[model samples]
Target chain A: MADTSETAAAPRTHVSLQVNGTTREVDIEPRRTLLSVLRDDLSLTGAKPGCEMGNCGACTVLLDGEAVYSCLTLAVECTGREITTIEGLSASGELDPVQQAFIAHDALQCGFCTPGQILAMKALFATNPHPDDETIERAMSGNICRCGAYPKILAAARALAGTQAAQQ
Target chain B: MNTFEHVTVTDGNEAVKLLSERGGAAGETKIIAGGTDLLTLMNASLIAPQRLVNLKAARALRYLRFAEDGALHIGALATLADLERDAGVARRLPILVESVRDAATPQLRAMATVAGNLLQRPRCWYFRGAPHCWLKGGAECFARDGENKYHAIFGASSCVAVHPSDLAPALLALDAELLINGPSGVRTLPLAAFFHEPTNDARIEHTLAPDEVITEIRVPGQPEGANGAYLKMMDRQAWAFALASAAAQLSVEDGVIQQARIVLGGVATVPWRATQAEDALTGQQLTPELARTAAEAALAGAAPLAHNGYKVPLARELVRRAILRAGSVPHP
Candidate 1:
């Protein structure tokens, strides 16, 4: 067992992470969450930490194109996995369709949960290009907006769903 | 969360060996799969392990498939999302899928493993937030006398907190078995035998040894004409734990129930098997009245706490609805 006695200094292991099409290396303790590493180390503050536990979806991010709560993910476990944050959503300086819809639909009040919400919808569209209302609601249920922007968020998602379906 | 050394194990045998060698005590060396529940517990200061054995690298254990005998075998690392999206599971054992469909959230389902979900601890406010709860090795159970609207209504000795897993009751009703790897090698345990109410002596909810690593969950083939359903009553439409839930599986032939398995969740310290309810339904005709009788029998012995009396009737109603749905009988 690794020594966890009071006097023992915490061990830090080196980990390589593939974040937003880039390879980043960091030496950190094993307990550091992916959210903390993203915000504190990598300076990607888009993913907020609402609840350090998995209850709030403020820290939602895409891991291998699947939505997951970064607060619940360990930095070390993310090795070799593709991670996409809100900052990475539009790396080409062009707003993604989901982000564009969020703006076009006015889907924000305080905008605290918008990043997580956008990432969640991005993951949904990645898996299912054109989801129904029930699918959209179920997929976005994890991201809570205390400002009651759910109706607007739904409108944005619906607009995107229509566009994607028409294009397909 | 306190900093801890993390080691990744590629297989269950290596995990067991590491636990046996490095695990100083029963709860010191923790095994982390998905880290959905364990990380939360650690963040709450409920448990501070010295080392976490990351099982995410145990790629071999991440599987869901059916055996030739029509039995379902789910690997320990199979996420709840895997079960939710599995068409085979939906066709064969839909109750399992139903139980996991609205459990927590999509992100949680994506990260929570089958074994991790079954092994998660209670969600009682007192046990989770209070520092002096009995389940946390403190003197008293505050939920027994304090606010306990979501507490257990049955089989709570020292801890009135209910089991929080939605999948547990469904799996218990299906009579699943667990394959565990320990220092002595692998052993299979009936799912029913894996859980127990917390007592003064053990104060734990499960029978898994410190060195044991759950490798697979084996659900036996159901008899012909068998069907099952899981019904949960939550405080909200979604993203909430069950206040009371019931899972019922029945094998009926020619409108006569040949066998039944009834289990209740979020109502006891363990996944409660409603044996009396099962007995009431066995050899009986599928009818709304019979379902009500079984539901009544299921909660006949329930001893509700000061503030959780509503759970009795609520659970009874869920049991009734679950039975009706499983037997495909019209509600009267």
Candidate 2:
């Protein structure tokens, strides 16, 4: 249990949330963004904070299955929402299809932004399983790979989406 | 970012009650809806509120629907992604969808709300930086004589920062009204009249009082045979703010323009309504020549600052192209 003080200089709140299909709780300052809390508080550092602003998608996460910038989302506001980060993309220690495709297509180099990119691609597939190249490009536009690995990233997305379509 | 007390409100009335109870002249209590813009400003130390009233829990304020009166009613908490995907918005108000489609990237659209987009601060480098400009209670505006290529070319009341919302000009072109909730009561105002030019009060942007909150936005239905379009020119293809943008809505009958509204963005302190351009289209046959003339008329009164003379021509071409596109109706 955390004491929420009204007159404290740094106001704190007790937020109990479901992250990666598990219940988690933290007493944090109100100004702490979800990205900071995920990385600093709970040690879920898969979501990188490249540009603290929303311009960079390196801090992307799924809030209740909707893709949002974790950097701009307040930790307090996500008290009851379900958050899925890159670490939670797979179940039972197996790689998610998007991660498998990334490895198969060499979708990353330097690998700093790989988690965010994989999560973004995972989100795209969640909504549109067979997204075309254009849809993939538009959906992934927010996630910038500074290493210029866009060709591989797009290839990986196409591979995953194609597999879904072929299976259907 | 300065630490602040955070309290989640379940509804508009509760939010207003809290604000009215603890609000002061210095804006000690601030509302946080989407936090896409407010968080950035706080991280930059531009605004330091002692308390934040979080409205994300107010699910009542998150909706988009066409009312019985044929008006499109959007709650303040509706995300830009919600508007982008609504079939009615794409059909009845395609221009609104287009305005938001290219403004920010997908992730931002997912996080930013309608009210947050409408209330976001200017993207001016000077204002966002550490300079205590006129908008920040300083004596003079740094962009008035400084690097002002992206600053205002019209309606610059001692502050040349351009209004940054892509949805504002489009909504104004459609003649929308904003439903506001304050301590006194709920009231509605024309969207065009809602924005105010910067004055001695360095703490406010729109006409919203410190204790007031925008609950919903109502856009009147367009006339039959009315078509609208929005054109935004950006520095790059993705994730760039507009260099200049234009929104045009015109009602045409039998190849003749009956009514027209033209609004320009990224070149004014407010959304600049090109009355001259609208006037040029009324009661006239739609022609490329008329659009060019209307485009010229649109910039007839522009007073560009130091490095933004290029926006005059850019805005002119965008208005002309937008008018032509809006009036490009199939023959009956």
State which candidate has the highest DockQ. Answer: 1
In model 2, what is the error at residue A167, expressed in angstroms? 19
Worst 10 residues of 2 chain B by lDDT: B323-332
Could you report the DockQ of all the candidates, in the order they appear? 0.56, 0.54
Chain B TM, per prediction: 0.98, 0.96
Report every candidate's CA lDDT: 0.91, 0.87
Q: What are the per-candidate TM-scores when only chain A is compared?
A: 0.91, 0.90
- For model 2, residues B45-102, the per-residue Cα lDDT tens digits are 8988888999989999999999887889999999999999999999988989989998
* Pairs that collide, model 2: none
Q: For candidate 1, list the clashing residue pairs, or say none.
A: none
TM-score (C-alpha, index-matched) for candidate 2: 0.95
Give one digit per residue, the lDDT tens place, for model 1 in B1-332: 77777999999998898888754487788899989889888888888988899999999999999999999999999999999999999999999999999899999999999999889988888878946789988899988888888888888578999999999999999999999999999999999999988888878889899899999999999989999999999998779999999999999999999999999999889989999999999999988999999999999999998888898999999999999999988785
The single-chain TM-score for chain B of candidate 1 is 0.98
What TM-score does the A-chain of candidate 1 achieve? 0.91
Model 1: fraction of native contacts: 0.82
RMSD of each: 3.0, 3.4
